[model samples]
Target: MTEGDSPMSSIFAAMAPVPERTIADATTLDAAIRAADTPFVVRGLVLDWPLVQAGLKSAQAARDYLAAKRKDVAFTVSVGEAGSNGRLFYDDAMAMNFRVGRGKLPDIFGHIASIENQPDAPPVYLASIDMDGFFTGLADENHVDLGDRDLLKSIWIGTRTRIAAHNDFPQNLACCAVGRRRFTVFPREQFRNLYLGPIDNTPAGRAVSMVDFHDPDFQQHPRFGEALAHAQMVELEPGDAIYLPSLWWHHVEGLAPFNVLVNYWWRDTPRWLGQPQDALNHAIMSIRELPADERAYWRDMFDYYVFGDPELPRAHIPEGAQSVLGPLTADSAGRLRGFLLRQLSK
Candidate 1:
């Protein structure tokens, strides 16, 4: 059988080993993708058309076209490890979803879609694209040639290829053409449960999929509850996609031997009232400019908001007061923290 036709040889194949699931019902796929926590919710989501017909019905034809147009493909700028940096993949790492300006994209993998023959390489990240420039055109309807946007950023995600837990910058709609996929989602609050890989927003691909809900070792990750309570997941078939919110952690797997998918990356509204704090730059500044003790203090201070517990981590100013904390309250800590935030923003 040709690579595309042998849909069961993938690691996530029906024959492959997996944890027993308690998932019930076999109705709407979107519900499973959004609410499934245990194997308890195993079903199908039959959406995304051009993909299913083109991939499953005419596998050979699609593969032939994909192979011939390899050079025309211009994505695969490794954001992180499909293994090592799986966490980064969680947040709109899929090239297509990002409403990126031409200035931001690096075109790292180049547009040539190479039919990967290397055993070391995976096939699940096989075929995908963004077409951001294409959509932007619909709004303005200007003379958008999509010339430089010619780079086809598709992932030939090999089957059994697993991506770690993480969320995208926004909601993503993915369409599978030839194969099927599985996704597990953790809401934004579950960031701690996921043993995140890197601070660099982009992923170079990673080995570990985010949280292992199948048989979680709660003892090892005590704080994992923050993730467990908000879990959602699903298995995607040809022509199906999942909509994931920003900061939500998710693990993904290519279920079929020959998997082909197309996803759109879109952003959610900004989280902060003002521009996002340049925490990275601050981290660098602390490490470089401060003495060792000062740096450590700042590090802890940073943790108070980013990693510290939710109840009383750091402080923030109230909405409409003259006090540094915005509004004055009986709590002095909040004011002090607001002062610090102001200092940081400056």
Candidate 2:
């Protein structure tokens, strides 16, 4: 069949298009990150990185380059049976459907090499290994010049893998090092329509949408149609990168026999500010199941205290007496934590 007539093409034709922004160098990238409002694709930025050069030669050469830089540290790798079809997802019982095995970098690389030529090999993924800890000098060769910010760099290596749609806490920059990839992103506002699975029990590190992108069961997850209407897609080449804003829901597909991706994750939140996810968990326990009238009261309280004006609430109270209502600093946060622990205990 022709490209336009293909099933995948028909599916993609329905979703919103993701915008692409070509960044020339590190200076342009810095400007983009400073104004981080939406997701954008960066092309030609990492064309000169050594890893990209390695990938251009061959997949084996790329593997060799990474294997040469391997350190003696153990990291977790996800192993899925061939039957799973490269998608790391939940089983029928809503439990995680993959096995995690600890392996060193070289061993993982060797496993990837072994399955390189297999027609129907099982999905073996060395997912999210920290670049700084294991592949020490690798970053020096292919790193983003984010200046003084403490950015976490991680690598994802796998063969034709699919990671379910999930939102991350930090802003992300995923650079394709050795193969092509397709990223389907949706705005945070599309959360309700995305049909997210269990929050407490997740397949991967984060809660994933139950609706499968490859073959979505509309009967079971009918609301997912609305999510698709608001979706955006981007395809990345070896040297391409995509910047995802914090809390943007993204579904990732590694589209080659042997794929390697390097991602940088960072957030602009202050260290003194407590994790918003923690507050979400607390709300789930305390507020989620409350009666509508009681929840409505809490909503107004949140608007007045947490979501609304910060300085206005403490305008009357003395600075020292403001306690948890005041600005969050190391001492104030500690006291608030203790107060929360006491409340939870009760």
Candidate 3:
């Protein structure tokens, strides 16, 4: 479709010079992060870091390795972005060339070194830095008291693909190297201006696609101009990193081939109390338990809760009811589970 075709999207361009480069020292990073109000630059984010160094070496070898392994491999597909389940090759668009799963070499994608040597060959793997190691480094850098930040749940994704405008789930510390990547961030409050795409397209259910930055079709989506008034953009290379708060809408893309990105993702700290179900789970509960009439009511309720409304309590919630906000311990979790279980249980 056309740029900014959707009315629910917003765009952010490089509006100012970034914060220049630094060693990403813990003390320096803590301060520099606050100054990154707008999209800014942080050079050498993770180039020398041992984690990224090895991944780049791995990506370089993928060129010849994948050629021999492609016969048995197939493109990994999500529900929507990969086409109507018929697209050729996986979504290597800009992902790092690397492997996944057990002792197997994955059909990774990266910038092809030369065509003369292997003209028909595909790009090699890139962006395969150690996920857990990256986060452990962040936890140490921030001194955030991450009780379990070293768990193996870490994930490092590459293949230079466009991650449309969407909020991240876990807290994110995206460290880059080798090549460059541009990250455009809009405030959480500006979700309205961002014409979001279909959520089912991504595994995380994020809204894919974003409003074009340079030349948006304002005629169709005139409201998107508001997003320009307040936006942030950053270009990250080796040794640079950005602290992405939980659930802040961000649009990210790889600017070059063979770029390296190592992100440290950690779940939010557990709270003392309150129900802790996420928006998606809560949504399923509303849809399944509530009748058609009630379900419609819930749609507006969530819009009011998440969008805008007076019903949202502005005052502090009493400490007693607050414990319900913790997903693992919240009574709402049990209720939500029971609500869904009734249907699945049948």
Candidate 4:
């Protein structure tokens, strides 16, 4: 049998690994970013980063490096109960299992350090901390130059933890700055099989898979077994990184006692085009509850106008009169936003 087609008993063990590449310089890394269409491990891409070097020495050293970069910034940190066992998720009542508290970088780092070797340590996750916002010169000292790409650089610092499988809208390059991390990924097509949680209410900003990666209850979520068939797994050591294309679901695990991850997020589209999630939400509110036949008609309309050929309109109408049906510009996008606001206000 092909890899990732293993029997249920040895599911993770026989899953396919993400392709690996050894990148040595900025030019090669930039090219990889431009060409990436799937998830792949970029081995030792950030091996020379100061923070990674510190982490290679010891967890304490890694913490010290982060502490030194503090800029008197207060960060919102998530602290899960011991019972949660490092999974930042929702409780039985659908309330979040973790509580957020504001703290400085050093205090958060110190808290993570205190529980480094403790048994059953409560999960202390300071996730998605904006590197430029929280730390002074940290981004400059420890980052890969991605050429002209405008990136949202974020850092995740935590104890041994598991982030539920989630997909972000932007392409991601995740660097393992300290400790070890394992990523189990599934492509966008597996959305139906993943058993996603509520879009409106989420543990984090994005809707995540309800399936527990550590001990997946395949009986309850039978389709999850189907998702594993397309899964790819990779373990990243300190200084290694992985590139994941947009909207690919990934479940992340911090395998070591203390871990720090730096991730870069960017979209290929222009900033003014707006988010696709917003469009999905609007459709759900306006179109989801419509009559079946009407919904089907609207689906056909969407297929013809949005997803199908752009040149199809030119044959039926004059080019200048095409209006919103034609190519969209930043200025036109602003006007379209205004038009949407007017329609919504009614």
Report per-prediction Cα RMSD to one decimal: 11.2, 2.4, 8.6, 3.5
Candidate 1 lDDT by residue in tens digits, 90-125: 444534211222211123222212323333232224
The CA lDDT at 65 in model 1 is 40
Which stretch of 10 consecutive residues in model 2 shows the poorest summed lDDT? 1-10
- After superposition, candidate 3 runs with Cα above 4 Å error: 1-42, 51-160, 210-215, 271-339, 343-346
Evaluated against the true structure, the overall lDDT of model 4 is 0.88
- Indicate which candidate wins on TM-score: 4
How far is 130's C-alpha from truth in model 2 (Å)? 0.8
lDDT of 2 by residue, 1-346 (tens): 3224544566876666678886767788889878877898887668889989999999989988988888877878988867555788887887667789898777887888888668657788888888878876999999888777779999998888889999998889999988888899999999999888877888766878988777778899898888888889988899888999999999998878889999998878766566787898889999989999999999999999988999988999998899888878888888888888899899
Q: Candidate 1 at 218: error in angstroms?
A: 4.8
- Quote each prediction's TM-score: 0.48, 0.93, 0.57, 0.94
- lDDT by residue (51-89, candidate 4, tens digit) is 999999999998898888888868899999885657899
Number of the top candidate by lDDT? 4
C-alpha lDDT score of every prediction, in listed order: 0.44, 0.84, 0.48, 0.88
The residue pairs found clashing in candidate 2 are: none
